[model samples]
Structure formats: structure tokens, C-alpha cells
Target: MNKDLEKLACKDLIDLALLMPKKFDDLRLNDAPILNELNCTKVVIKSKKQLAGKRLTCIAYSYNWECECTITIFNARPFHNALFAINKELLIYGKLNDFAGLLQFVNPKIIKNSGEITANYMIKGVSDKSISEIKKKYLNYESLKAYDLLDEHIKLLLTMSENSSDAMLLLNSDELNECLKFVEIFHHIRRLNETYKNDTLYKKLKTHDINKWLKSLPFSPTNDQLKAILDIKSDLENAKHKIRITMGDVGCGKSLVIFAAALMTYPNKAILMAPTSVLAQQLYEEAKRLMPGFVKILHFSGAKTKFMQDELQDANFVIGTHALLWADISDASLVMIDEQQRFGAKQRMRLKELATTNDVNPHYIEFSATPIPRTTALINSDIYSYSFIKELPFKKEIETKLITIEQSKELFNHIRIENEKNHQAIIVYPLIEEGKTNTYKPLESVIPYYEKHFKNVYYTHGKDKEKDNVLSEFALKGDVLLSTTIIEVGISLPRLSIIVIVAPERYGLSTLHQLRGRVGRNGVKSYCYLLSKNEFSDRLIEFSKTLDGFKIAEIDLANRKSGDLIDGDYQHGASFKYFDETSDNIILQKAKEYIHKLQDK
Candidate 1:
């Protein structure tokens, strides 16, 4: 075996056994067809003689056919002369050529029929005879029911487990030719897991009375939120630095769950860092309102240097933006980060390391407002602990509708009515201003129509230096706000009840869902209008029906065909090469099953 092959196989019996042959070369054919074709045969060496320039010539003919064959060897050694004896028979395999009605075999693999044993195989970079010998030495595939899938090949190294379902069934997919390839990949990842177990272990927990603390909350928690809290509770019960992620849709109460985690830590000082100052301040305010007065909460912002330093020393729960990284967190044992994906890995990790004490990693929990596919979660379960809040605490009464140019009047009327009811509305544009080559004027064209018809009008985009001020003004008093997808993640507007996306196709379903989530935060009626010229957007129609973020993720998964399973940022924004993590649940499950079977054996 080559060192590389040994390395891949790990010299493990099962691994070697599972290395299926890539292809096979047939050497069992006897005589070539009577027609003109090169072939193999058992030929008798009728005559042999040495030629000029270290060459040998042999006149031969097939034993059972009327055809003659010529065997020529160049740079012939003395051993060649001994092998090509007069009237000696030999079994040969190679391509033959008809030269002027004369059949000839040149430099063919010659196997002497002189009581010498031989075998055929087709492993790349390995001698065929050696592989055949290994097969001969190992395979004892005798079954009462005569197995066919394993045949006599794979059985050579692997025992057919009775628990394994029709292994061939797992490999066959008429719709996608990639099925067989995915089957191979599944086995490969399973094998890698045997040596590279990524999950960790930590010390057990003793004092975390979350039940009493949970009872103090004003509003009851959703089952999913409670389950996530329980999961975190279990994670913290141990001394292992609890690094867990809680993923939820917008308004799914992830903040409250983070609060629960903080209380679970109890005496262990807890600190949280948000991506934006606005988000940090929002969380700080919420924590103060819900948390007991005994829990001193501190938020550092602007030039509150003196007050910040004073609170840093006494605060039990500290919340701040990235600026908190510079503050002292020497006493913190539980560090929670909100909107974890928004921060850079170095920033997140640096914050994590800040809470580490005496080499004892602090319990770290992260919050994400976006939802990933379930299959992805399963595949990465080994990498990091994850909790999902798939459902919201309340069902949003948001109605999503597709609007066209023909229905432009109807859409405007609805927005006006929403505003009349004292609720706010926003119109999202694909562009802040029209490009010179743009077929249609974007925000510029709509400004006159909206300003002429609506009460207060405000517009902002990524380039607007005063965009934050515009957004704040819009949130406070503006009735109609024209913007870009920048409103997808931040700034919750409870009174904002309607969103009209001018060109829905420009954004993905996930992005659209994030925008839709911006509305109906206060349980008030909401409406989302997807305005576009393209009428064939069935994905948008389907997305309109489900308010559940997890369901929206499934829709998003179905639209994209390829992505990698893992990426550099610890599985964040990773794609898959062999299988779609969004749709290949069965394949991933089978891989997990195969690993368990191998381990049990």
C-alpha cells in the first residue's frame, strides 16, 4: 500500500474495507472476434530469435484459432530469450493491430502458462495482482442468501452489517447522479469524525436556581424560549466554559432569554456586548425594566467615563457596545453577546477571552436574530452547542401581498389608510437614486408621488451621512419613510405597520423576512406589499403565508442549490459541496447512523 492510501485508510480494517474500487479492467477475454480487432490469447511460441539492437522476435499463433500472432520486445534482456521458447504456450493481454492482414501484439503483458499463478485487479497506483491477492487472502463472502451489493469485492475487507439497510439503496438516485458521490462523502466525513471528535467536556454545575428567577418575569416565556433557557441551564450546570448560541427570529424574545441566562449565572458577574450602540442601549433599558432591582445593570456610552468606571466595579450585569471590550471584565464569569454574527470573529473571540479567569473559560452565550436551516444545525451540532427559537411568543398579524404597477393605486390607498389610523409606513427602494443607465427612476421618482400624497416623507440609504438621524426622525414622527434593506436588522418601530418593497426580487426571502419582521412588533395589524413587475415570483407568494422564520429558512434553502458544509468562520455562512445542508437530512442522518454502527461494533 502507498503511504498516502495508508494515511487515508488509517490502516483501519473497516476503512480499508470501505475503500471501494474506483473502476475495473477486464482481462478474462479469450480470442478476439473473427473480425478485425486487437485481443488477448494463449499463443504458442513457434519460433524465437535475437535481432539487432537488443531486440527479440517471436512467431506465434493462437492454440484454438487459425490466426497468427507476432510478439515483439525491444531492448530485450537475456531473460526474454528464455521465456519465448519454441513451441511454448503463453497467456497474453493487450491491444492487437492488423498490419497488412497480419495480427500483432506488441509489448503485451505476457503470463506464462507454465504453472505460474496470476490474477487481475484495477486499483489505481497499485499493482493489480497485489490487490487481487489481498482480495483472495481476505474475502470469505459466504451467505445463505447470496449478497449482491457487496458481491465479492467490498466484502473482501468489510463485514456486511445486518443492521445496514440495502446499502445500494442509499447510493441510488435516479433524479440526481450525485447520489452515489454523496454516499461516498457521507462515509468519508463519518470516518474523519472517528479521529477528530470536536465536542468538549467541562466540569459539572452545582448552584443555578433559575426556576425561582423565571417566576419573577412579568410575561410568561414561550415553550421554545423556555427550552432554550433549559438547554443553557444544563450547559451552565457544568464547569465547562458554556459556549452556546441561541438563534431566533426578530421579536422572538432572544433578549429575554439572554436575561434568563444572566440570572442563571446569579453571583457570577455577567457582561453583554452588542454590535450597535442603539441595540446595546435597548438591551440595557429592557434589562433594567425586567431584572430585579438588586441586580445592578450598567451601560457605558459616550463620555460617561467617570460614571462608567464607577459602575464597572459594582455592576452585576454590564451591557455596552464594542467599547465594552476596553473595560475591565476580570470578575465576569458569564459573557453573552447579542447579534453575534454582526461582530467579527476576532472581536467576538477577544471578548470571550476577556472573561476567561485562571484559564477557566467563562460561560459564553451568543444571540442571533437570523434562522439557519435545520439540516445545517444538525451537521454542525458537533462544532458548537446551538439552541433554536423557531416559534415566536405571539403570532404576528402581518399580511403579505404582491403588488404590481396595475395595483399601484390600491397599494398607495392602503398605505394612506394605515397612516390615517395613526400607524406609520415605509417604502423600501432598491436604490437610493437612479443610476444613469437605470431603466426606471428609483427613490427619486417616488419622492414626488409620496411627498405629494403622504404627510411627512423621509428617505435614507447606505451612503446618506445623516441616515441615522433620518431613521430616528422617521421613527419618531415621519409617516412615510423611503429606504433600502438597511432596515432589515436594526431599529424596531412598533408603530410602523406597513412596508411596501418596490422591487421584491432584488432581495432574498431571508432579507425580505427580516424586513417583514420590522412591522407588527406591537401586536398591531400589519401589511407587507411586494411591488414588482415580475409576476412569477412564487417564492414571495409562499413566503407571504408563513410568519415563522424557520419556515422561511426552508423556503430559502429550497431556492439555492449548492453551498459548502463548513467555512473558515466556524460554520457561519458556510456552503456545501457534496450535498445541500438544507435538503439532505436523510443523507446526514444516515452518516450519523453509520458512525454509531461502526462505533458499536
Candidate 2:
């Protein structure tokens, strides 16, 4: 790569082609000058130039208009003085300004050749000349064709890079925008295709009677959950190794799908990794109750490692926390991760590697309770197989509302009423300890007040060592739980009917949705109060209207810029500059078709 091109972040021909000009200089000679607009005309220097301080003034006669105009150059260099020599006929381009009654040209540029256009780039440390040269060398048909771009796309890029009159027209047209969007998506997908591989061998699981297993379940599986299980079932039966993600809203019954996948791979071992110990314990208990007695199930976490070695030998289904990453295990035909975004890339990969035997990678399926926008799922589907479960097993009756400090009495009375019914409430604070500049009360200061006013008040945060125990106890006996957002993703509190988020504006809509999901479990009537100083926040107000996590994700995307959605290994960084994931679905669909056509060739 050329150093100058590297400075502009151009790694290849495609990148160089996409480097569009910031502006274009039209130097075509005009028959008549348009006032206050850029014009180019042949002019004759009429008088000797006069220098005042750093300014130079001269008179020039426009041959086309047959008028003499005052030309002034500020901070004139030696080249400016030479260009305006007396009696010299030259072509000059500048904004034709009419000051008061006199026509004037300020710092007019001498055009060596008229009837041409020049591209002006804004790249720092790289001159326009260098960019032009790079474009001329690499922005040709043959160069871009090597990257498998469609011929029409290559031509459009060439026209844009040429800086012609047609280029200017295309710059303002929607056609160019569509073409750029297609190119970006096409390039990204192709890059992923080149690097993505599924060469690892895997033993195909024999077909099992999943429908019969579903019949024995206590409750009927929703259509979405059944479809997701079927999707995973198909992947397990295939000879090729599989990678799929099952995403859904909170309480969408993704757990049943996990167990179904494990059952499908029965006789062959299956393993699941959860984000927290509490979640792992909950899943272990659920598996024991729901799974049939024939399947041997084992739970592994930091606390239960003493007997893991002996238990692993014949364990048909293993569920554990991050401690499973370091455990010695083998011969697992399938691997599943819950809340996949919570685990790092290395941790997930480590668990998958532990299950691999004879270089055969286990079939991997990740479950996400954090719902993403449909458009993002569509775009990402080109890289990984996706299954979305939108239907909840039961309707959640969560009534969300925005409240202010003045409404404290009303909020407290509501909590008291819930407590009278043997229901529980949780107050989520933004911080554990009060900061010097904090505007809202922290958990430390508010816990004492709750302890004084109410009974069975419990508090915990991310740094708390006994958080798992606290959450377990809170689920059984606590009336009110005062804590931070640590309870956002774990535990199933059946009696949790009310959740009050302090300073709700400090969190993203998706996060706020996750916190709101803590309540309304078991289909009980619940309330979510957004305890904020500013009650009229449009985001919170809009959030209070719907219980759809997917819709909240869309709203979050609309409210935030790119690169704020997911973190850790699942993050799709800001790779597409022109493709708007929010509104470019049509273009993405077209690009997928075009790429498929090219693949057929």
C-alpha cells in the first residue's frame, strides 16, 4: 500500500473508490457571470498591480461580459503577483461578488485549462494531488472487478471518482446513495465470507422424537419457541458444524428451547453456560424438574467444583457458570450459551473447545434475552443463522409510568399495597455509594431509609460477594429489595410485582427494558415506575407505553447513534459508513440478491 493512501485509511481498491470528494470545483467557462456564484471566464489584466501591506489589487477585463472588474487578493504570495502581470490574458475562477455597486473577484484562482472539473478532498496530511493519483491508478474497472463487485457498481464508482459533470449530478441523486449502500453491504458480507469457516467436523445426532418430549412438558410451548427448537434441531442433524443465535424478549421461554436442544443431542452430551451463578443454579433446578429422569443432568459453578470431575464422566446435560470454562470436559456434541452477550468471546470459545473431540467442533447455539431490532437481525443473518422468538408464553401485565419526587407518596402507597398482598418490589439505584456530584440518592443512603420504614429490606450491587445469596433470599422472603442494576439479568422472582428505577434516564432504553422485565414475572399484575427528576422525558414516556422488547430496541436504535447497541464479542462495530441499519433494509435485500447472483456465476 502507498504511504499516502494508508494515511487516508485506504486499505484496498474498494476503500480508495469509496473515498469520495468533499467538493468539486467547476471551471467551465461561462458566457455570463452569475452574481454571488462561482464563475470562470477569460480575463485580461488591464493595469499594473498595486500592493498594500499583504494585499494585492488589480483590474481585469472579462472578455465574455465585456466589463472591467476589480480583483483583489489578500495575503498575496509571489505566485499571485506573477499570475496578474499586466496585459496577460488568463482564465480565472472565483465567486463573482457584487459589493455595493462594483463587481469584484476576491482571491480568484488562475485556471490553466478551462472547461474542466476538479475534485477537492478534505483528508488531512494527504494532498489532493496524491488522492487523485491514487484514484486514477486503482479506481478502474479491472481493479475493482478483482473484488467481485458488480459491473454496474464498478461503473458508478468510476464515474464518481472521475469528477465529471455526470458525477456532480449523481452526487445529488438517490441512485448514487443506493449504489453506495449496496457496495458497503456487499463488501462487508464478502469480507465475512472470506474469513468465516466451518471446516470442523461434527457427528450428526440421530433424529429424536422432540414432539413427544414436548407433549410431556407441563405447559405448551409457544409457536416461536417451537420454531426455534426446530431450527436448532435441523442444525444438529446436519453433518456440517452449526452456529446459530436464538434471540427473544424477556420471559419468552428461550429456556425450553435450550433444554429441547439438549434433549435432541441426548445420548451425546450437551453443555450450557450461563452468565451468573444464580442463573446457573436456577437453570439447574429448572432442568431437574422439567427434564425427564432418564437424562443425567449436572450443575457446575465455582462453588460446586468439588465433585465436577466425577460427575462429568457420565453427565448427559451440563449447566454451569464461567467456571465451566476451566473445567476438564470432553465428548460434548452440542454447546449452548444463555445471555450470549454477557460472556466474552474467549470464554465462549473456551467452553466450545472443551466440548470438541477428535477435532470435531460441537454444534453451537447462543440464546439472547436481550432483543435486538429486526433490521439488525436481518442484516446479521447473512453472517450467522438467526432464530427470533417474539411471542411470550404468557402476556406480561406490566404498567409502566414516569414519576417525579412529588409523587413519592403515591409511589410509596402503591408499594405498600403490593406488600399487603404478599408481593415484592425492587428499587434499582444507579450507584452503590453516593458520589460527590450525584444528583440522586445512592443505594447506601437509601437502604437505611427503607430499613427504617419497612421490614425485610435487602441491598446489593455488582461488587457484593454474597449477591447470589442475597438475590436467592430476596426471591423467597424479602418485601423490598434495594440494589443497583445487578438484578437486571438474573434470577426468577415470582412475587416481584413492582420495580422502581431511580434516574431512569441514565440508562439506555434496552437496559431500562431489561430492568422493567424484572417485574411482571408469573403473569401477575405489575407496575414499573421511572423515578426521575424530569418526568416528561420523551424516551421514558415512550418506553412506558409498550412491553415489547423488540420495539424498545428499535426505539433505542433510533435514539442512539451506531455502535451503542451490543458490547463484548457480539458487537458489530461501525463498519458501514453509508449503510444505515435503521432504514436501509431494501438496499440490503437487493445487495443480498446481487451477491447470490455473483456466487452463482
Candidate 3:
């Protein structure tokens, strides 16, 4: 064994067995000496000699056969001449030929060392023949039995390689290959999850403490929210270094979970980092009002806070925007990040590092409003503890509609009627001001038309100086707010009833789902109108039928190929390397269950 192979990450025979081949070739001998079949035979070179210019020829016999097996080796090196001398015994594996009145082996790999197979393991950037030998030595039914994996799944795994005695009888070659793919993917995910062992770091959370805090709130938590809190609570209680990512639809009441996390980590200094000032301010206000008064909560955003810096540091719970990444809150034992996708890999990892102490990492919880596929959530389990709040706490009555340029008049009439009812309306244009694209009308171009029809019409975009104030105004007294997708997160507009998106095809379904979430907070019938002209309109039309953001995520999975998975930026979504997140949930669930069982053990 070389140093490189000895250092391979394989812990035991199971690792060797689980290294599935990217492909397999048939080298099995036929019942008889059938021509055109790849065969392996033991032979003695009866007449062997070097020909012109590295060409070597040999006549070999196997199994006391009368027919001579002619072997012509091309580009023979010096070692080949020494090894294939007259009367030397050899094992030849290659394509068998019936060219003339003779049986022949062409370009055969003379197996001086049996079980040696060339393979590319990918991790080492080098190829090794010893891998085949190792697989042969250790990859067996008993080796699988030692791992304690699901019996059915393991049987499926071996059947893919045709290792089971009756596997081929049950499945044809094509069927086996197809089913074997699931097996290979199952192992790939299993190996990724196995690395999470031995990394638990956190103190147990008391449910009674959480119950006491819940009593302080005016409203009760949703069952899904409570389930999420319980999962987080269990993780906090069991591990020292906790990593959990909470994903839910926008307006699914994730703030309660964030506040609950802070309350659960009471007296241990919980710090929260939100993506924007508006969201940070909103969460800060919620925490201050909902949490126990004696807990001492503070908000810091954009600059040094009005409160004394020491007070900010010493507070039981602190909420801030990106300013939190640099805030010196070393007493922090729990760190929660809101709208975590707004930050890149460097910033998220930096917060984790900053919150961490010398002995253990702070229990980290990340909150995202983007709903992801269940398999995607499972894949992410390799790095983060995943929890989903898909069931809405409050029923959102938003009905989606697909409209085109021709339907502009009816759309305007609906907005006019909604506004006349004192119900607020938002028209979200793709562009703040039209520049490059001509297909979509910008806000500046259309505001005049909207202002002419509706009263108290105001407009704002992401760069608006008074965007928060504008949103505040629209939520209160304004009848119509013509804007961009700036109101996607954190604004609770209970009166806003309709969101009309122009050129809706330009935005992903997730963003549109968030924009649609702005309405229907108070269970009033809310409407989402998607205006587009391209053939891409069908997706938006399909999107309008369901209100489930998680279902929209499934459509997103099929429409958009996944992005990078390396940096943990699942916001744009990381592509699955092996399994299809859409079709492979069964395997994903099994892998998750297997890894979770291991963690428990």
C-alpha cells in the first residue's frame, strides 16, 4: 500500500464498498468459447517473441485446448518482453476475436496482478489500480451487513452491481442500471451525512422556559411553528455547536421562532443579525414588546446605538443589521440571522466565527423566507440542521392571476375598485426606471397613469431614501403604492389586498411568492396579478393556481437548474451533484433517516 492510498478517507471496508463505479464493464466469460465477447483466460505463452519496433507477438494456449489463442500486444515495453517469454504462464483479459481460423486476444491487458483495475477516484486527482483490488477484497454482502443500514436499501444497493444472486433475474440490465442509480446516490448522500458525527455542541433547552415565554405573547404559536421550536429546542439541548436553518414562506410568522430562540437562550446573550435596517427595526420592536420586560432588549443598526455601548453588549438580547457582524458581543451564546441569503458566504461564516468562543461555537440559527424542496432541505442537512414551517399559521387568502398587455384595463379597474374600498394596492414593476429593456414598463413611465386613476398614489424602489417611511405610509393611509419588489420581506401590511406585478416573468417564483405574501395577512381576500407577454407566461399562469410557497419551489426546481452547492449559498440554490432533488426524495429521506439514526446512536 502506498502512502496516498493509506491516507484515503475510507474508514473501513464499508467505505471501500460504497465507492461506486461511475461505470462498469462486462468481463465475464461466456458458457462456451464464444467470439466477440470480452473474456479473461489463463494462458501459457507457447511461442513469444519481439517483432519490429515495440511490436510483440505471442501464441498462447488455455485449458488444454487444441485451438491456439493468438495474442498480439501493441507498443510492448521491455517489461512486456521479459514477462511474456516462451512457456511463461499469464492471465489475459480483453476482447476475444475470431478474425481467421483462430481465436485471438487484441490489446489485452495481461493480468500479472489479478484484481488490479484502473480507476479515477476524483478526490486525489490521480488514478489507482489498487481500488479494484480493495473492492474485490472487502466489498461483499457481509461487509454491508456490518453497517446496520436499512435492509431493503442495502439490498437495492448490491442489486445494482449485480452482487445479489437473484438480482439479475429480477431486473434486466437497463432496469438494474436505473434502479442502481438511486442506490449510488443514496451512498453519496450517506457519506456526506456521516461526517456530521461527533460535532454536537450545545446545552439542553428547557421546554418549560419556552412555555413561560409563550405565555407572555398575545397570540398562540402555530403548530408548525411550535414543531420548529421543539426541533430547535431539542438540538440546543443536545449539542454544543448547533447549526439550524429555518425556512418558511414570507409572513409565515418566523419572527415568533426567532424571539423564541432568544427567550430559550435567556441570560446567555442572544444576538440577531438581520439583512436590512427595516427588518432589523421590525424584529427589534417585536422583541422589545413581546419578550419579558426585565430581559433588557436593545436594537443597534447602521451606527453606534443611542444606548450606551456597554449596555448594548450586556443586554440579554440584541438585534441589528449587518452592523452585528462587527459588534463586540462576546458574551453571545446563541446567534440568529434573518434573511440570511442577503449575506454571502464570507459574511455568514464570519458571523459564525465571531459568535464562537474558544471552547464551542454559538448555537447558530439562520432564518430564510425562501421555501425549498424537501429533498433540497435534506441535502442541506449535511451542513445545517433543517426545519420547515410550510403550514401557514394564518390562512393567506391571496388568489393569483395571470394577465397580459391586453388585460391592462381590467387590472386597472380592479385596483381602482380595491382602492375605492379603502383597501391598499401595490403595483410592483420589474424596473424602477426603464433603461435597457423595452418589453417591460418601468415605474417612472407608469406612475403618471396610475396617479391619474387613484388618489394618494406614492412610489418607492429599493434605493428610495424614505422607502421604510413610504411603506409605513402605504400600510396606514395611502391607497396605492406603485413600487418595485422592495416590500418582499418584513413589512406586515394587513390592509394591502392586491399586488400587481408587471413583467412577472423576470422574477423567480420565490420572489413573486414573497411579493404576493405582502397581502392577505389579516385573512382578507388578497389578489396577485402577474402581467407578462412572453411564452414564459405559462409558468406564471401555473404559479397562480397554488398558494403554497413550497409547491412553487417544486416548480422552481424543474424550471431552473440548481446553482453552486460548494459555498452553502442555497438561496440561489446549489445544484445537486448526483441526485435529482425533485425525483429523489425517497432516497433523500432514507439517507436523512439513516444519518439521523447514527447521530442518535
Per-candidate TM vs. native?
Answer: 0.65, 0.84, 0.68
User: Candidate 3 local accuracy as lDDT?
Assistant: 0.71
Q: Which residue pairs collide in model 1, if any?
A: 203-239, 205-237, 563-575, 563-576, 564-575, 564-576, 565-575, 565-576
- State the lDDT at 302 in candidate 1: 44
In candidate 3 the C-alpha lDDT for residue 445 amounts to: 94
Ranking by TM-score: 2, 3, 1
Which digits, one per residue and each the tens of the lDDT, describe model 1 over residues 1-601?
Answer: 4454364433333333344343332344454433334355778898877889988878898865666777888899888888888977788766777666777777778744422223222555677555554544443455211322223333323432211223323323342234333444454455334322333443244545767767878878889999998888888787553357788888889988888888777666788988766677778888889887778788877457556787788887888888877877877877888876466556776887786666666677778765444233533434357789977766779999887878988988888898898899988888867688764458867788778888999988877878768888888988999888777766879899999887888776767887888999978989998888877477888987888766776676667422323222442343443455555667667656655565587
- How many clashes show up per model? 8, 0, 6
Least well predicted 10-residue stretch by lDDT in candidate 1: 143-152
- Predicted candidate 2 versus true structure: per-residue lDDT over 1-601, tens digit per residue: 5775687886567878888887788988888878999889898999856677788888889998898888998888888778889999999899999976778899888788988888888888788777887788767788889988888889999999886898877885688888888887777667655433455667688956777879988899999999998898889998884368888888989889999999999988899999888888889999999988899999886777876788887899999888888777777888899987576556776788888888777898888766444224433537567798989867889999888988989999999899999999999999988799999888898777899888889989999999988998888889999988888887898899999999998987767888888888789999999988874667778889988766776676656533522222344345467888768878878878887898788
User: Which 10-residue span in candidate 3 carries the lowest summed lDDT?
Assistant: 161-170
Assess the local accuracy of residue 288 in candidate 3 as a C-alpha lDDT between 0 and 100: 80
lDDT values, one for every candidate: 0.68, 0.81, 0.71
What is the lDDT for 390 in model 1?
73
Question: Which residue pairs in candidate 2 have backbone atoms (N, alpha carbon, C) closer than 3 angstroms, thus clashing?
Answer: none
In Å, residue 137's CA in model 2 sits off its true spot by: 2.3
Candidate 1 ranges with C-alpha deviation above 4 Å: 1-216, 240-243, 300-314, 322-332, 340-360, 373-375, 378-394, 436-445, 463-465, 561-565, 569-574, 597-601
- The top-ranked prediction according to lDDT is 2
